[model samples]
Target: MATLSYNPSKLRNHKPQSHKPISSLSKPIKIPFSSSQFSTLYPSKFSKLRLNSVSESSVSLPTNQPPLTSASENNFNEDEEVDDDPTSEVSYLDSETDPENIIEWELDFCSRPILDIRGKKVWELVVCDGTLSLQFTKKDSIFQVANADNYNKGLQELGIKPVPSKRCLSLLLWLEERYETVYMRHPGFQVGAKPLLALDNPFPMDLPENLIGEKWAFVQLPFSAVQEEVSSLEERFAFGASLDLDLLGIEIDDKTLIPGIAVASSRAKPLAAWMNGLEVCSLEADLAKASLVLSVGISTRYVYATYKKSVATTQEAEAWEEAKKTCGGLHFLAIQENLDSDDCVGFWLLLDLPPPPV
Candidate 1:
């Protein structure tokens, strides 16, 4: 219950004046979250701690000792009444973090020192030798409810089918990750939670886990807000023994796979590993739009039936006859467009990481 600044009085009177940030919002439903919340810069923000001090030194995702609902959770809900859309019936765990009863926790999560002290919700997953922490920032909307049910249906539809863990991770990201802070359980990289903006020197990343904060605290997040949080993230993928050595932004912890229901496709898909030869479907005739990082993530099952692009389509061969003739005209070589078909559309690309060493 400590903080860099404990201004209970300021928090009580604070009311946001500008509506610009909420401009992109369509239908304009008002979701009154706390005044001083954190980042919305990246659709999803993630950082891990790699603890060297724990008894069993290991590479794990952010973790919390089991049963995460904290007891001080209940009274916050009773202190204030939150207004929302009448049509929105999403329910969340009944817990609150009212300013009148706020206890300031340190701003630092990992190596980063955050000033905001808002409530966050998280899901804990157990992986190989570590624990995975999926933290989120919540938002309110009917769109979130639809997104949640869609993700739920996706998991169930693929009941027995084996999907890659990476795909599953992507699906969750595409659903929601509204503006908020995110941290891992075991602190995979070990260093404290450093703000994504604090990268000035080469990462001396090897450090201790400093993400300790209130654990097992329950907060009632409207279902819509919860879904918004899930969608705003960018799922990360890392495999191979050398994943840790790269210093590239990819540190690790996650997975899930999905399949194309309409067509058979093992057709090669673009991958994060393809950084050396990063290719986009169309050239950016407009630099601002094409060059800009459009947010992308894997949702459990996104049914893009109308826009399916299979790289494995042999039908393309018939169309590439002219390029083939030119290669033959040179007498030494034959021409052909890409014979391999792996649609790159489904790939959820992460931009922050340094590409793997050439």
Candidate 2:
């Protein structure tokens, strides 16, 4: 996670305003985690596993750690989403002839449904784009398996920090497609051996007590107002989330009111500093849990607020859903003084996007 600091003295006062209701808005929908008839896909652990391969002899995960499981967290820069056009949800490379022109890639380096010359399982590298329109494949026997230590070391070698972002929807969907059309056709394929992978997010953790602000409130501000304030802030640990709003058929404008949580604390600086280290993604109103879940780093959720502090009603859920669509799924976390203060200590602009498809 990257950090930015700005003087709070330069902030502008925003008057309290009623959030405009979005009429005829679509109802809230959960991220499609289950096949319509096959129940949930991969289990919890498999959702975060990358399909890399290593020699059986080189596998050395700690005794307590799961073998060959590590979320390859990427430090997705804010610029990946077009900064100039807030309405533009995706950014693409300029080359049409370069081949593999998509900015992000989905990969699967794992055992196939076939055997090699030595009667060993065949391994291959499968690549595809989000839409599944493009495909590339390579047959290989060995590659570096991804694990926590290997991921951290790779980032360290590149002189960069790890900031996990969204899950790889392309690879996930590809897995499901293969399971349905390809893998199941093999005579030796066993359902028990190759379990279905799921997109179940990890349980939310408790926030550090000290990081809780003195006061916080659910607020709504105009899109222009929120964007302007974030821009005016001198210091910010920011991430502009990439969204596929076109897929969702959501639209927005300057007057669109975005929903967010505003935290005011005497220890605002320290609070912002602590959050800066976490890859804060989006805030969700979990109706089933009746909790406000803060999604950060790859698949890590935190209990931002419980029902006791902030009730989760259908109306609230619908409001959040509407706001998310209208604003291209952009939600914010504003760390500042009391609700009335004009100055912002730290600001974060975030968006929640659905898992990619292939």
Candidate 3:
């Protein structure tokens, strides 16, 4: 038999076979690897590995395979998971139960109209807001008084009938009695042409039974008495308070009954402007004669005055000094006459009564 000799150059010159397109493949190709080899290579356990053909965009994951999570993520606490959830409802019971969250309601006063039984004009009193609406009759009183003709004329312009002077007087008396109940416990009254009214009740409807019975009273004073008695009382008393009475336009001879609200001295102004027609020199002279030592208290609504009573005791003097330190001291000092006396007069002289002991 004759053996055919093949040259290496002939094989090199031969054309190679063409490959088929991957899109023509019927199924995904398998990646051949042993379990031990995979463990050694990747340090992870995976079964039945598959690879997509070149024509496919992505590989299909096995349904039985667990998602790959990092060690840090796997170790996360359960609380953190709950916090991460946006829909989680947080409890605020701790904050709600805190004592700091509790707030005391404060009383605020305003002015309102007083209508008679016939819904006509009754002389308007500077009363608390809710009080008039609650206490006054809705109907207008038939009795008309001639004394308030000017007032009645003004009311007639507004289409309101005038209330009789007799009826008006009766209503005033009744209102005073009613207000006494409301203000008896309170320290003083705030009096002015336009005073604040109580639009809403300061106390909650569900307040404790004991608190419901608590009452406040108004300290009614005449403008003249305030002017005369205030200086004398300050001279005699160790304690005094400041108030803002500039809006009142109180004249020396005017018989305006100014109501003062009871408030802590701290709330009072350090100095106030003197009401219209008040003589500064006379007031200063009065204050100087008494050698008055003034100390402001908690509220500015009323000033407390008491006679010095044979010189202040050592303890009382010390206490007055301390109060002066705490409450910004008296508006006027006997030695400090050249200072702003008008400001001192306006702010410090609310009333001429001695304050109750702290």
Greater-TM-score candidate between 1 and 2: 2
lDDT (Cα) of model 3:
0.24
Writing each residue's lDDT as its tens digit, candidate 3 over 54-79 gives 11111112335343222233452323
lDDT of 1 at 71: 22
Model 3 — TM-score against the truth? Answer: 0.17
Task: Provide the global lDDT of candidate 2 against the true structure.
Answer: 0.50
Q: Model 1, range 1-358, lDDT digits (tens) per residue?
A: 0001112233212111111110111121222333122112212212221111212222222255233332243232333443322111112221332333422111111221212122122222211110112222222222334655554576579562222222122213312121122222222222343433224223112211221111110011222221222232233232101111122122211110100011112222222233212221110011212111111121122111121123321222212222212211100000001111111112222222221110
Q: Indicate whether candidate 2 or candidate 3 has the larger TM-score.
A: 2
Ranking by TM-score: 2, 1, 3
Per-residue error for 133 in candidate 2, Å, reads: 20
Candidate 3 residue-wise lDDT at 346: 26
TM-score against native, each model: 0.18, 0.52, 0.17
Candidate 3: residue 270 Cα off by (Å): 21
